[model samples]
Target chain A: MVKTQIRFGILGCAKVGRKMCRALELAPNTTLYAIGSRSIETASRFSSENFLPSSVKLYGSYEAVLDDPEVDAVYMPLPASLHLKWAVLAAEKKKHVLLEKPGASNVSELEKILDACESNGVQFMDATMFMHHPRTLKMEEFLDGERFGRLQYVFSSFSYKASPEFLESDIRMKPDLTAQGAVGDLGWYCIRAILWANNYQLPKTVVANRNPSLNKSGVILSCGSSFYWEDGRVANFYCSYLTDITMDITALGSNGSIRLHDFVVPFQENEAQYFQACNSKFINLSTGCEPARSGELVRADLPQEALMVQEFANLVANKADGLKVGKKWADICRKTQVIVDAVYNSIVRGFEPVEIMS
Target chain B: MVKTQIRFGILGCAKVGRKMCRALELAPNTTLYAIGSRSIETASRFSSENFLPSSVKLYGSYEAVLDDPEVDAVYMPLPASLHLKWAVLAAEKKKHVLLEKPGASNVSELEKILDACESNGVQFMDATMFMHHPRTLKMEEFLDGERFGRLQYVFSSFSYKASPEFLESDIRMKPDLTAQGAVGDLGWYCIRAILWANNYQLPKTVVANRNPSLNKSGVILSCGSSFYWEDGRVANFYCSYLTDITMDITALGSNGSIRLHDFVVPFQENEAQYFQACNSKFINLSTGCEPARSGELVRADLPQEALMVQEFANLVANKADGLKVGKKWADICRKTQVIVDAVYNSIVRGFEPVEIMS
Candidate 1:
């Protein structure tokens, strides 16, 4: 019997690529098949500095990784502006695409990438690691349970104080490299968290908050926006590169409420916790109340990134088992990009409400 | 030496009045001097049910409590529509006034009450209990410290599920009884929390969210709004009667973040906790982070309500020490009411942004 573990290749030597390299090594059904950079020396140096296994392949150019017959999937962590080109090439080569988020520069670019993957019969997923966390599933259960009732509101914030060096030299500060700045870097996670809490329902309209601060290059350094659904469900998100690192999600429903202070990245690698309260009420003298909250600790056998890798590999192997490629994730990725573009449009139009056509 | 305890007259038998009655009893410088209702039997029954001392006075009309010479201060917990009438009468009688929140139907009515208090030369303070909590002081210390830096963002949500009976018949559900409905009841806290977080600086504009759900009489049952400062500081709040009870305040500054789950009425009467994070950063493999958070417990010698009564009494007694009547609290209350009115106006104008004119 032949072993058929999914083969993974990562593009670029971005800071995030180091984490994905470790995730591919830890994921049970995946292998670290290749690492690619524009320069062979850079890729080799990254491999050696990280002490990666000797059997892993190294390529000088991204196209070499896509052309490698043994690499079953490409984990594209390239900049947001570069996604459309590399992702389409990877898909045309029959490689499943695991892309980083803000998956594309805009909806049109994201649509082109998605269409290429669909045409080539490959699974496509954004590298949103927290989505694969066991705690997220527990939160979803609470949101979907009878005790929780229907969801009404969601609020999320993600921010970190970027170093002076990062502000000066990071690709994220370059408009041609990362179009949305903090909106792409930190706000993507916040927007994804909000959409996930609402079961990926695209909001009818998006309104940018009036207090966006832009950098010298006119890139967003900090910003916020609100999402409105026709059914009265609403969500808001804030992201910044000018504040201390904070990631939070609060979802309120008719009967229950859930909150996590570190939803994007858990405080601990192996465990995550969320607080929930149900049927809360004020009692005796209004000093105390019923439905005292309790935090549920979810233990992860593998870290969230590893689980994300494992989940993507499972989808790839499922296709090998004669199943149809999963379009649900691609559809979510497209919708998220559409909202991101809508928020940008709204901000550019003096914070006017932008109707989400989709 | 002559004893100088401030005397408190509670001018209603409402459920909240019971809590205030206990607070007055517990406050070191205050005594429960009088109880009043439309019927003498009702006042007497309330005193007996609440186990009031036998020496306490009972009155058949609110004006009777105001007329009592021994009642140095009046705690008016009347319905919103009745606040302007009774509070003015109490102020005309030269009694220091401690009034319940949503102190009047709108900003104009609140301004009238403030004017009356100013003309009478008596202290005025709203009975916003949480403001007096020791936890609030501790949180303020953190916010003011170098570690917290300058305020950048604030988010607050206060909600509670209204029972069917309460929705159908409670004063909070009636337009004449509570003109602002959930906005007056729950949103007052949220708006107050945001204003307090910002050092009571009024926002330049207030924009109500588009999805406010209103009762049949056109009172807001659930709503949200955003406040924008001139220097890019932003605050938003969500208040509701249709969601599970959740009181949350998350204030993020340039250097640190502070979060408290039970900001309004804490889960415990004597102790409250807030979490603060400073200089947070991701460490090792981006899996875990540095500067992990720790909760600070603020233990109170007196319950928040009792502290509120104590603080108000101190201001009243200060008048005897040749101090002018404390106008700080009244000013804060007026600003909060102005923002509340602005939110209501924005909603009334089809969710347009209303410029807040001080």
Candidate 2:
């Protein structure tokens, strides 16, 4: 039988890479073919530690993975500063790219990688796994349905308390590696949530909250931003490495509202839940509310990461079969990066209101 | 038997006044001594509608209720513009005052009312009924305990869609009657919740979100504000008259989080609930979290409003027995008003960051 599954090569053996490796194995339309690390010994150790099948290849350098004609795609989990270089190189080699979040150091660097993908006619997507979750699809329906009326306010928060060792030495806290720090690493999810709730409509202005917590190296450890639209819509988000693990999203409409506690990742892999209240009102004498909020549970056939991987593989397959390259994922990634850049700009400019240009 | 119960007089027949009338009847330490409206017929109608006992006196004017020597305290449900005048008059007449919220139009006006209450040696408390809920006490304990660790962030929202008639004719939308509009009406509760979560420690600065929805008369219909503290604590709140009814508070600490959907009023009058997650963490591969959040239910023997009235009556009785006036409620009321004032000032100043004075 002729093999039809897309072959995936992973560049780097970072901690997050292990999850993607599992996802590639779980996705139905993808095969985990190769993993490349700076050293062959490191790649070999990662493959064994993760119990990857011996059939999978181990390459000593990222260039070797791109050089292999059998590798159809690459999942890059390199640090943010290196994304521009390796992502462009992978695209130049005509390989589909699934880049980890904080897609690049800034929007300018991200644009370069995007241009390379566009020219090479290969698919490009950031590894925002939640976007592929079935719960997210249900939430989008609720926001679009009449029961929810029109979206007016959105608030999201994503934070996790980092250990003392991680804070002191993690690449995320190093200015040279991840200059955007918490805003890029965590606020990326929050900003994506806000934009998703609004159906990708960019806010007119972005203003950073005053007094974000920063480390000795001047990397943001905790931060937040307020967003305003021309139609009186408003949103705000907070992301931190100094608070408890919490991923929450509350979207309030004109007539209803929806709330989720674990938006970025579910409490469980197979099932996720969200609470919705439609036409809720105060009862007589304003003593209490009518129609208590109802929780909706959504079950997933595959974990969200696997679903994301499958979706990316399908898009790549469709393109190979003469379909137009999918621009949806790329568009979403660019919008998220724009807002992330604006937040950083606002912080650098003393928390001024940074006007977003489109 | 000698009369020991404090006698209460209600100063208006507003919609909210109906709730307080029920509260006064439910409180064991108070008596519904009298009700005053614009006219004797109106007062009589209100008394009948609320099923007040015949022994409750009916007065044609507010001054008549204040002049009644047997009336120990006054619950004023008048509009925001009238609170300063009526509340000060009630206090000057030796009647303890339970003023409805927004407390007054601004902090300056509230200060004047506070001064009158202090000079007359009468107890003063705002009708923020949620503060009296047992659930609030429990939540506070969690916030202050070691499990929750130090507070880092707070987000609150209160909103309700108003009918066309209300938008056109309600005193709350009139500039003269309630100039602060939705910020004063709905934002009051959100600000109070944030302040309460932080133990009434004021933020260092407050900045209003741009483009607040306003009526033709320039009364705010929707608005939000971001608050910052010197120690990197941050909070943001949104309030509106154009969205579905929602009262939510999410307080995040270093190690735990507490969230309540109906923070302003319970979904059920007899019991209130909140959710808390302590020491939650992502499990292996970040597929799921460990120790899911837990829900806590607190039963109330009396409704929150009734509890508020009873607490105020007890303070009045203590003062009557030569105990010094209780200052805690007054202090909280003042702190809430200062933040409220700062929010309005920031809006007026084009969303500038207004420094808050402690």
Candidate 3:
């Protein structure tokens, strides 16, 4: 029997925020208690349709939801640039916070949000949806061991230019607001993959750089990042928003290399291809192979969001500390900022290999 | 209509020289006249029995065949370490010379051989049978005219491992002898590809680097070369013996990218693939697809060996100069030497990008 359910009040009744509302509706020991948006009509529609009786509350503004003593936490799906401000504000209201990906503009912004949670005794974490996907743990398993052999190199490239419909001069386009586009949108995904393989340890002296020309914004929309792990395994990542959307990662090891296609969105069949190097001969580990099926998740499965929500519940219910989760979020945010900043700086200064300031 | 056929004398009867015998056996106006090996029995057995020449001459000493006035030209496939030594001797004897892949051990040595050929007034050219292929002109057609779009990048890689039969003590294992194993073997092939595409124009600057720990000798066995063509196209190449054999070149233009599969052997059955950027999407240009048939030499049918041999015949038969041929040979040889040398230097100096000294 479930007791002591944690309720979430979603801020910003945007598309992602609405999706989170549906996820909360299905989650065990959770309920969508309230809705908040700048527009009262949007919040009212969500609250009335999803919640029953006094369980439903509508707010004309985000601050109204945070101020409500009845709400335990608030989910922040505002623009990436506004994440830090809202997260800190929610923490100040003693409400646990689930901030979306690119968690805060950079490392320092993430730290400030985390600090607010600490002082106010509230939980704070990034709602990186990929993290909630269980198969991601399978990828973690693949890279965790020496089964693939001593890692030599890593290659990842994620790309997709925003459709004209999506490129509506949003917060993402603001250079100072979003720290550029591709780095936050696609590049962060690659960095997370690297960190996952590196045991959450940052690379030693990364040769990360980027050159995003052609994108109108002064920010780099194309970037190449290189990571040199302590173990001498080098990882290189290529990301571009001026291209199509696809995720691929290749890990070259001493004995064989592993190529995980659709890594960002692995086969619903969960296919993984292994390439074995037989003393200079590359033998395909999977030839004419069918992709293994990925685990099926409900539309509201919302694993990454669910995990962030669950972690907050554990912190409050079990009195568990969220130091590790907050720190990892900070680390990812920090490296991404350093890399993207270096790339733009390098390109501006003639595309030299700019050493990451981090 | 038939005239006196050009007679070929082979020294060392090595693998390449043996392959030369087989290719000459297929040649239209060519005859294997004589064979010379360190051992007379070896030469005689190969010349009389294996090759089955109408009249065969065998010589135990290299100079004996070089002095053969009947032998119009010599295909010298000696060990890489011995190429310069025998090439000079053959040139001094007034025999038209066909040196294998790397005409000289080093850039300085190549210059010295060039000097010898000029002073002796004897025809000399490197036996890069690939250039003889008829398909090269087709590729030239694309790169020459503003064919598709501005050429921005070129990526080429060629790799293959040693057969299990390779002995550790073989000359391929000797550092000083086969100083540039992968670089000279595979790297030279790619360099030729770029030069051929650029119509013999030198790149403004060549930035080269390679893996340090992978090679046994200090010389580069795996190399990466970046070239800035005089017209502003950037070409990059990768070479390795430690990877699978991939003789593919991807030329990315503003509007599209052309993929040449088996570039060293371009006349394959199918067109590899072409990617064109359209409407903010890359569409694979499989618009024109057809089956292959024998006796059909499309753009890919560049009778590489035939051209080199014919050029040699033209230069020798007319009592004319091979200066143009020599110049091209010298360019490839010198550039290969420059890149191989620079890449090794880069690795030794901590994987730094080394500038080409050519």
Candidate 4:
């Protein structure tokens, strides 16, 4: 029997990568065939520690994994700082791609990846796993439906609130390392969700404000931005290392609203939540969890192994659209980075309103 | 036997003021002796409507209430826009005062009020009515124990999300009429709680950012403010008329954390909550309102009637120094106004960090 299931290749031993490996191994018909990293020892160690069925192959360099005929797609879990370089390379190698989100550091870099993937026949998906989640889809439906009434306001925050020294030169903290700092890292999801719900249209004006410590490498510690969309939707996006709150989204409309109490992490425990708008009241229907995927399997719980892996397997095996999936990932990356960069620039120029670039 | 209960007079029949009259009637020893407003007809109607006995004098002008010999203290349930004006006037008449929250429009206004109260040897207290409630005291005791370790971060939001026509000159939308917009109205409690918890110390710095909108009086709209205190505790305060959420204060510390869920509204019908703490191992403890207050009250149930009236009764009957109560209230009120003004100044200047002054 010619097995039609797409074989997955793990690239890099990042925390996200290690977690994705577990999911690839679980999905039916999916095969975790190989592991690759810069060092042979690291790749070999990950395969042994994480992958079951020791038959999983280990390769010294990422190129060797791409060369392998057994693996059909690559899961680039490298830092967002390096997503463009590897994603473009994987497409040139004729391998499909599922690059972790904040898909690239900037527009120019993401454009290179998008052009490369289009030139090649293989699929390239920016793994926004969130876009695939059922809850967000339901939220989008309500936002589009008359139930939410005319959309008036949106409030979202996805801040890690890490210290200055947590990762000194980490891409999330340094502008030089990543085109944007906290705004893109934590703020990307917020910006993208707003853009996605409002359609592909752009905002007419963007005013941003930032607070950066002079003691560091001009990395923004806290940033707040207000974007006035072309559709007349005015939004305020806040991301900070200064305030900590749950990751969620609430779309407030004229008559009523819908809130994903855990919009950021949908599969908290294989918890399937659906919304039913009957008459005036909207109800949140949740299926809690099963004994099989309960406890640590919950996204809010430690060891968020299943959710990340399932998204990886779907992208690799499903042949998801590079333009639909990959372009959006890069697009969000750019929009978030542009706004993030604009905010810091506004702060530098004394809180001047900065227009976000395309 | 001398029956000395605090004889109370209320000025203004504002929405919140009518609520205060009810609270005054509930206190054990207090008498709602007189009521005054701008119109004698309105005052008479209020006196009759509230079912006040005919002996409870009705006055044509607020000044008549201030001068009435039977009136021991004045409770001003006027708009935050007029707190300072009435508070000062009441003090000048030697009437002890209970000024409403966001205590004044600016520091200078509150300063003048304090100065007058001091010179006239009168008592004054800002109506942070929540603090006098048992829950606030209970929560503070838990936070102060330091078992949760040093307070790290605080996330608080107070919003109205009311319609555009909420009021023709609603202070929420118009910054000039309200001085600083929602930050003065809603964000006051969040700021007051932080200042109260941290003691009467200055924050090292504060940064603010607000949404763009034309207030009725051309006031600013939504805003975000971050404050860093001398002790390294950080707090983020968000306020808006475009969106409203239940107020929550999550004080995360070094060891564990204590969350005062639903921090603002004192009334929760079936809404019972308690503290539950845990480390890496076993569960610590959990306690909440096994006994619930009737959730029907619209924060209209503040013990202001009992506490403020009792304090006044004590001063008149026991000859206690009005100095301590007056000074603390004055200090809290002045600081809150100063913070509100600083936020507005920062927003006008594009959310620049400013030093809070009182």
> Could you say which candidate leads in DockQ?
1
Assess chain B of each prediction and give its TM-score.
0.98, 0.98, 0.82, 0.84
Deviation from truth (RMSD, Å), model 2: 1.4
- Model 4 / residue B356 / CA error / Å: 3.2
- On a 0 to 1 TM-score scale, where does candidate 4 land against the true structure? 0.79
Stretches of candidate 2 exceeding 4 Å from the true structure: A1-4, B1-4
| DockQ each | 0.84, 0.79, 0.09, 0.13
Cα TM-score of candidate 3: 0.66
Rank list by lDDT: 2, 1, 4, 3
Which of candidates 3 and 4 is the stronger one according to DockQ? 4
Evaluate model 4: give its lDDT: 0.60
Q: What is the DockQ of candidate 3?
A: 0.09
Model 2: per-residue lDDT, tens digit, B74-169?
999899999999999999999999999888999999999999999988899999999999999989999999999999999999988888999999
By summed lDDT, the worst window of 10 consecutive residues in model 1 chain B runs over B318-327
- On the 0 to 100 scale, the lDDT of residue B208 in model 3 is 51
State residue A167's C-alpha deviation in candidate 1, in Å. Answer: 1.4
Candidate 3, residue A226: how far the Cα is off, in Å: 4.8
Q: After superposition, how far is residue B138 of candidate 3 from its true place, in Å?
A: 7.3
What would the per-residue lDDT of candidate 3 be over residues A60-128, giving only the tens digit for each residue? 988899888888877887777788788889988888777766766766676788788778876655665
Q: Report how far residue B295 has shifted in candidate 1, in Å.
A: 1.2
